[model samples]
Target: MALCDIGLIGLGTMGSALSLNIAEKGFDIAVWNRRTKVTHAFKAEAGELADKIIATETYEELIAALKSPRAIILMVPAGGPVDDQIAQLRPLLDPEDMIIDAGNANFHNTRTRAASGEPFIGIGVSGGEDGARHGPSIMGGGPKESWDSVAHILEAISAKYEGQPCATWMGPDGAGHFVKAVHNGIEYADMQMIAEVYGIMRDGMGMDAAAIGGVFEAWNKGPLQSYLIEISGEVAKAIDPKTGGAMLDAIVDAAGQKGTGRWTAIEAQHLAAPVPAIEAAVAARNLSSRRDARALGEELFGAAPKHLPHETLSIDTLEQALIAGKILCYAQGFVMLSAASEEFQWSLPLPAIAEVWREGCIIRSAMLNDMSEALTEDPERNLMFAPYFSDHLKKNHGALRQVVAQAALHGLAAPALLSGLSYFDTMRTARGTANMIQGQRDFFGRHSFVHIDGSEGQHGPWAD
Candidate 1:
């Protein structure tokens, strides 16, 4: 048997799609799965592509099939499974051999695993099943030399935006997954803001799903155009076959999460990064999960008072508000990324990151292209302070403020949107109320407050 260029373990949907994609790129692949049946099934499914894929029933066989300085990609579950696979493979591999974890493992864990004297790359692979089969955005982080060894294969299989592959070596030790977590965090905020807008249309304006779907469809063609927005329109328009009603109405209200967004929020808190929009989105998902509590609250308080009448709300205003909120959410995510880069000494390529996100990922949007350009122009400043986005917020902030106020008055839960508006408002404020917080902290906890004139820390004597 001819030696394969790379070996892949795990035959899950993502794993299979990625393997097929790699093979289609003309690289011979050796594949193994925990279950022999799965490996065989995948080989059968490969059809004509099977010639390029070597299915191995054992780890030793898989290892033997790969060439010297072997590259093996693991598509197992995050956490224990990833560690388990690495442990199993380490004993059979040489120092120069590489192990790439392509799942959504936490970045800290990636760092720990890499520090174990193993040549490992924790890569972030985004875009869903279809994207895995065709092309997906890839962000890799490990030793620069290790990354270079497999860079050609990764770049070849990644999605392209105007001939530039949506793949890049982010930074050493877990930067890729860290960026991926922030990506998901921004995704949470994006989806939540879209849902909030749909809520306003459905409840505040008394519009049906079809009408709201049309609104989202229109938004998809404008500044708000994105995969999430486009999907929201499709989801809203879906009809239930059994009930002949809107599919969204038939679906459950509860939202499910896989922890990346939560991780992003926790990391933001640890880094002292203000990511209220992402936090609010994660909180909203948690709130949604407590359906029983919500029901009880509704019974206790009676129905929420509806203040924003259907005739009073404007669809145009809602669109503008969503655009502003999205901008704020992206700003928060990018700011968090900047903080993480500084804290970790990663020197993350923010412009390249934005460029990678412009094509294949869930967050892909025209705005990302603009973001790439903005960051390229001023790599040091926060995204909110970028000239293009600052002007964007300046133009659309009124709509955001109005929408937030309307949601509050009407008893709607638009937490993400509200947080976005607040984040934007706070960022632009030269004199915030932090001094009061500092004073209270100093009085209660002896955490001294610094003066504005670069003076020494001072404490007040409070009279009881």
Candidate 2:
């Protein structure tokens, strides 16, 4: 077998797709799997790309098949499995050879591994199985030199937007995974907000799946144009083959998660950064899992969702409200990213991060193009404060407030949308309720509050 450009472990869906993509990009890649049969099957089914793949059954053969000072990618499950693989590879691998964890890992583990004086990097790859086979957005971290050695291949395999690859170096240590967590957090909020609107259309407006899908399709042609929106349209448009009814109606209401969004929420709280929309989305998922509890509540409360008449709210207004919610949600995500950057001293490029998310990633949207431009002008400022987005908020916020009010009046659970509106309102306020909160805290806990009159420490008047 020819000496391969890279060695990949774990011949699972993502690993197989990525290996084929590498071979398609004209790089010779060596591959292995925990199950030897999987490696053999992958090679047998590789078709023409098999010519560029050297499938090995063992770690030693995989290493031997790669070129000197080799680079190996681990596509195994995150956490313990990654550690076990690295431990297995350490004795056979040279000091200069790199171990890249291309899984959705918690960034703290990445930081520990990166700082271990080893040739290790943790990266975040998005776009799922199809994207891995074609192109996905790649976020790389660890040493610049380690990244540079693999940049050519990563860039070639990344999705492109306007001729630019959606792959980039996102600072050192766990920066890439941290950014990926935030990406997932934003994705959760985006999907939640979209689902919230879909609820409004279905339950409130009494629209069927096809009509709701049509709405999503129309939205895709405008600022809401995105992979999620486009797919939402397709999902809604799908017909159930068995009963010939709406596909969405046939499916269960529960949404499943793998915890990246939760990780983002936890990390944000750790940094004392506000990401209310993402947090609300995470909460929504948790709430959705309790089908029994919801049914019980409906039985106990004697209140079901009442329809919102179209005379009071239009689909156009709902679209505008979704637009505003998306803006607020993203602004919160970016601010959380800024907080992480400051706390970790990663110097994460917020503009470049936006550009990287412009294609391939789930959150890729037409709005991100404008966000990239805006963040380029001032990366530190809130995205809503950007000239383009600020104008958008100005025009759409009233629609958002209206939608939120309507959802409340009727019995719809639009937590993400409501959270987005609350965040937007809080951000625009000058001198707000935090002072009252501080005073209450001081009266109870004696934590002390900064006086408005420039006194260093102050206490609330508790009838003392």
Which one wins on TM-score? 2
Could you estimate the TM-score for every candidate? 0.97, 0.98
| Candidate 1 C-alpha lDDT tens digits along 256-358 | 9999999999999999999999999999999999999999999999766464764566888898898899988998888898999999999999999999998
Candidate 2 lDDT over residue span 96-169, tens digit each: 99999999999999999998888988889999998899989999989989999999999999999988999999
Task: Indicate the worst ten consecutive residues by lDDT in candidate 2.
Answer: 455-464
Q: lDDT, candidate 1, residue 362?
A: 92
Candidate 1 clash pair list: none
lDDT of 1: 0.91
